[model samples]
Target: MTGPSAVPPVTVLPVGGHGLLVELPTAEAAEALHAELLRRRRTGTLPPVREIVPGARTVLLEGLAEPRRLAEELPHWRVPPLSRTGGTAVRIPVRYDGPDLAEVAALWGLSEQEVGAVHASAEYRVAFCGFAPGFGYLTVLGAGYEVPRRASPRTRVPAGAVGLAGAYTGIYPRSSPGGWQLIGTAVDTVLWDPERTPAALLEPGTRVRFEPVDSAGTPIGDSADPDIPDPDIPDTPSGSREPR
Candidate 1:
C-alpha cells in the first residue's frame, strides 16, 4: 500500500437513519478533517452536509443527500490537506486536586507534581465533538501519562473536570456522570447560548494546554500562554439576538 491507496478510502454507507461512517487512517488525520468540517459549517460553505462526527480514527457525516446525490456532489467537497493550519492553542486553568488525582498519579509511576507536569506539557488537539454539546475529546497525552477510567463510574463529574481515559483526555462540558480518571478540574465556561456569534469555546482545530490551579480550584493566574483569545461564549441575551 502506498499514498492514497494506503489510506482508508472514504466509504459512504447507507444513511442508517442520519449518518454514515468512514474509516480514517490516524487520529491526527481524523482531527484535521474534523477541523475542516467545522470551519465549513461555521462559514456556511459546507456542501449541504449536516453533522460531521469523529471517532478514534473515523468520521461520520450525517444528513447528507441521497447516496446517489452524494456520489455526484462529494467529489467537489474540498477537503483540505492534513498539514493545513493546526489552529490556535487554548491554555485552560485547572486545579490538580481532584478526588482521584492521587490514584491516577500513582498509576503513572509519578508523584503528584510529575503527573501535573505531564498533563501540562502536551498540546492536545480537539479530536472530535461528542459526549455532549461543546465537549471536546482530546487526543493522546504526552509521555509518562497513560491512565485509565475509574474502576466504577462516578455519579456525577462536575463540569470542567479534566479527565483521562485510555489514551484520550476529555473535559466535562456540563455537570454530568462519568467514569474517567479525574486528575484535575478546569473552569472554562465552554457552553453558551447560540445567540452569540460564535457559540462553542473549543472548536475542532483548537489545541489545549492545561495550567495547574490552586487547591481551591481558583485560577492562580499562572497561565502557560496568555495570548490565546478568550472564546466569545455569550449569555442569554435580553432580546438582543434572534434565535436561529
Candidate 2:
C-alpha cells in the first residue's frame, strides 16, 4: 500500500488528527518548503489551505481535509524564481537601551556601544514567526551572533523590546512575559497592527535591519550597560520559550 508518506527528502509526521508536521533538514530548508507550500496554496494547486505554521526545522500544515492527499503531492513541491529571489526589506529603528544589555555585552565580550554596533551593523531576515503574533525570529545573515535566553525569565517584557536568544533576534510585538535577552526597543514601527491588512510587519524571507535611533528619531550615539549578574538560555533554539 503506497501511502502519502513516500517521498525523497520530506518526512511526514502526524500532529493529531487535524494536523501534520513536515520535517526538513535545516531551518533554511523548512523556510524554503513553507514558502513553496504557501505559493502552492495561493495558486490553487493544493486543496483549501488552513494554518501553515513554520518552525525552525519543520512546517505545520493544519486543517487539511486530507493531509494524506497533500502528502502525496509533497515530492513535487517547488518554489518559483522570483518568489525565491526578492524579499520585502524593512528597517526598524531602535534604541539600544535594555535591561539585559549589560549581560549580553558581558557574554559576548563587548561594550554596550559595541553591542549596539554589532547588532545594528548586521543584516537579518525573518527566519520564522512564532511565540506570539507579529513576533518574528530574525536570523543574522553572516557570521551569526549567538546569545542565550535569560536563565529565569522576567515577569513581563515591554512591547517593542528587541531581544536575542540562540542564533535569532526578535522584537516583542506587545507586552508579554518573556525571557529572551533584551537588547533594545523599536522606535515607531507598529509590529502587530490589527488595523493593517497583513497585521504582522515581518514575515518569513523579509529582510530586516535594526537602525539605531534616539528619542527624537535621530541617529543614536554610543552607550554601554552597567555590569550585572544574569544568565540562562534554553538548551535549543525553540525549546521552552513559551509564556507562562
**Top candidate, metric TM-score:** 2
lDDT of 1 at 210: 78
lDDT of 2 by residue, 76-171 (tens): 665332232365469899998998999988977878867777787655668889899999998753333588789999889999999999888999
Off by over 4 Å in 2: 1-8, 76-85, 141-144, 220-244
**Which stretches in model 1 have alpha-carbon errors above 4 Å?**
1-10, 17-19, 36-46, 69-86, 142-144, 191-197, 216-244
Model 1 lDDT tens row, 30-112: 66566677787789866677677777787788886654565455434555555323555677888777788789868876778
Deviation of model 1 at 42, angstroms? 7.5
* Each candidate's clash count: 0, 2
